[model samples]
Target: MIPPATPSPSAPKPSRQRQIGGLEFILLMGLLQALQALAVDSMLPALGTMAVDLGARDPNQRQLVVGIFLICSGLGCLLPGTLADRYGRRPVLITCLTSYILCSTACALVTNFDQLLVLRAILGVACAGLMVLPAAIIRDRHEGDAMARLQSTVGIVFMVVPMIAPSVGQAVLLVASWRWIFGVMALLGSLILFWMATRLPETLRPEFKQPIAPRKLAMTMGAIITTRSAAGYVLGMALIQGAMFGYINSSQQLVAEHFGAGARFPLIFAGMAACMACSNFTNSRIVEKFGARRVSHTALLIYIGTSALQFYIASQPNETLWEFVPMMTVNMCLLGFLGSNFTSIALQPFARSAGAAASAQSFIRMVLASCLGSMVGQAFDGTARPLAFALMVAGLGCLVLVLFSEKGRLFRRLLPPGTPRPIA
Candidate 1:
């Protein structure tokens, strides 16, 4: 069993301050992460309209808006955590939020496709800190199954934004131009920033603040990559998420254009997303009882099974909307069970370097997922086969990674004696 490293002995420990309440902490972290989701999901319904307005000659090119944001966000993830480790989480997060707000408003004012894509890239980079720092903060207080439960709870809240985001985009299109979608994004970002500034306290422990020397950074990266469980889960989760990203990139195309769900796209999208939110809620309730390894390992197998079914159906000539939707929804449901638990397990051995660890893992995951997602998105053939096949392949790859991480072991809970217990 991999054990988390203890706090550095050389660094001086600081006195703890009053931390935020449990419920509010979960809510704030969820919303901060949700900002990243809101930006992407909310843009889906408007992709077609924006494509035309921005003079995108090819429909697939419109997807670049999403793909570029995601890839740049991955690239952006490389720095913030290391900086946060040296400086502090709160100040770095504030700077990121400010930049995100500014870039979002700029995106609203873009007059051409090129201009909009450039702004989207910047927006994504700014938002990477939102994704990286929250995990670090959560790790500051919890570890192992307890951390997994908190993550699942935060995920339940985060899933709410995705459930309604496409509809939010659709609503904006009905009343005003698509640009107003970015306006809404900026407004929401502002509110979250305010809440964070006023309520959230610094969670990074004093002893963890080591100097940002090249040798130290290299050692940290080396530790993360060489650690068996950490590397395996990080790569495994990325493969599966890459499959999900493929779906996100193609959902508007496959559902609206291919399946004849044009007008009802938002409703259909919301329905699938609701499945995820429900799964997250269930995970938060049961993860502590069943254990992160047991639940996630079981879910990973089920995900592979569901993906295989989806692929088989997609290969058939007479596939219908009803047939495809059910299998896809099952896969989405399994994701909520897999994501937080995989993350917790991967980061379990890095308590002292949570920021650097989270940052490195997130960078690898996001870059790989975005590139793989873009490939899947570009592979759309006016059919669901590409997506179905990608999902199946992703699941198999994840299984292989997990096997390597555990040295062929599965479903074994390896908690050390004094790991933090689940928060009430």
Candidate 2:
């Protein structure tokens, strides 16, 4: 055709670079993070089946399937950033995805509860790479509220996976055994691994690459701990995540047993998750306008207020699903505002050491959060009391940490020098 005849010398190259640089880049990063959410959420429906089949004696012990995975994921978060910094993002990511595929496959074949837990722990370790690397990648390209906006956008997309993950698990359970869920995880991981190998470039710049020295690692970690904004926000994020996990751990039981939702639990859970997705989408739009600190601080106050109301309502006799669901949905929505913003704020101080900083932040946050979540989950008393109370305490704890990080400031439009403030 005429178009194919002769290309002008002034014509731009087919934008091959732009393909993975803009929307595709955000979508890819979102999918990478969604792998972690999928791993956890998709297994929720199968916990009871797994416990019974695997000979777990206590009902509380079923939570270990989730708790142990989180604990191990936290433990493994320390290494990926160092590896990513040394070798490069692409290689480290591919290796981790391969390990994830293998571990998930192994998890499908475990013969006992202990064996399954061991494999899941290893799988969680693989997932840590997926969790930490995306943040580093985002930091590689953008910073400040722009980074927060991108993170929230990713969260908006990533939240969709969790919203449907339980339903996907339930669908699997309807026709196949729980083991098939892990098989599905393996399949998805394989596909993503292939996509990544083909499309994902080395986002780590040559100048940013560093040798994996023990002294250097220690110094970087010390810097992270010593930085007020990083440390405070990281701790605040940890508490908020811990509180979220508490709800996750107890969700199936609370919905099925307490609310009598039974087979409808997946739909109920999906609705709550959808609230989060909406909130993330909304936060992505507004964070640039209000700044991360102002938006998140305001959301945190609402979260604290919601937690108090939820606790009060949960304590009252004859609490209905209508009331509980709305309250929980609001809480989740508030969390949507907090999670990505908190992460962006925490990681803002370290550009050169983004990988290491992300790893340390993930490690500390996951460990503490998982512990708090496990405690709340173990305290499940066949009522909503434990979850509601834990959330309230977590909200208060997060507030304190945020205050510490902000040095008594709240709702301030803080940004780096030379950054343009958003129009009010």
Candidate 3:
């Protein structure tokens, strides 16, 4: 295993690590972040209504409501982890949740496109706190198989929410306006706030808590980029994330144009989401047996393979919805299997600098993913052609990055012959 980066002379770790049910905590945390995701995807189907109702003249403007929010969320991923580290996870989470709730309510109340965009950005920033805090808290408590279990458990909640959130958003549109989506979001955020107030406790210990000083933050950021394994995993994640961005951007067009799924599109999208949820649960069960390194490596290979076949199909003239859906499901399942393991491995070597490390890693990955993914997603030529191109190229490209960053060592770290695995 890769060793943690060197800590400072006066560096400290939790003297008496707090004991808690990691699965429960991480799962709730995942739900909080998933709510942020729901904000983006849930409103996708309602983009036109939002645009027309608000009288946004620009065709590109409706997408900006969701697109800009996503970009902000990516930008927002930078700080919460470090903030949670300096302060306590619970307090930081509470503050973030409160801000998120307020901003989401503002989104619902907005009468203009500009106000909505601005509020969405604020909501994005607050939601950033939701995204980073949970991972940092979970990592503080577990490592290896235990960490994977916690991640998988959390991922199950995360994956499942995306499947249902859009449907709920669609249902809300049936009776109320798109603004009600924000109202529902505010309610959900409040529920999370309540949950944190009661069920959650500070995971960062006194010794582990440092003042949020400039030098410490700089040092923490430096170590992550300097560390070999940490850097590799983060880059690998960014590459995969870019593909995800492309998929999110293109799904609507592809489903409507090629599949002719029309208004029932979210149902099919939800089905693909279901594939991801199942894959995450399976990953949780087997990651202990294979180790994060092995599972990520193998999954990447399969993703690349699936993308290649997709590329071949996209080149053909007679491609149908059947071609896209099945292939995309396989692609998404790989996403579920890899997401938690890559994060666990990347953050593993930075335990001492968990807060700063988590902040920098999450921020960079989000920036990389949003920028690259957005570009690729927008490249769609009103067809599945661009989507397939991005998927295949990004999948293979990410695998190569993993190989390069890790110096070609992957899957070798799986359990030794006949070795047993542990479960949390």
For this target, which candidate reaches the highest lDDT against the unseen true structure?
1
TM-scores, in order shown?
Answer: 0.86, 0.87, 0.83
lDDT of 2 by residue, 43-131 (tens): 88899899899999988888888888888889888788778878888888999999999988998998889999888888888898998
lDDT of 3: 0.76
In the predicted model 2, the residue pairs found to clash are: none
- In terms of TM-score, the best-performing candidate is 2
Candidate 2 vs candidate 3: the TM-score winner is 2
Better structure of 1 and 2 per lDDT: 1
lDDT for predicted candidate 1 compared with the true structure:
0.86
Q: Kindly provide the TM-score of model 3 when superposed on the true structure, using C-alpha atoms.
A: 0.83
Per-residue lDDT of 344 in model 2: 80
lDDT against the true structure, per candidate, is: 0.86, 0.84, 0.76
Each model's Cα RMSD: 5.8, 5.4, 6.4
Residue 324, candidate 3: C-alpha displacement in angstroms: 1.0
lDDT of 1 by residue, 60-87 (tens): 8888889999999898987777778788
Q: Rank order by TM-score, top first?
A: 2, 1, 3
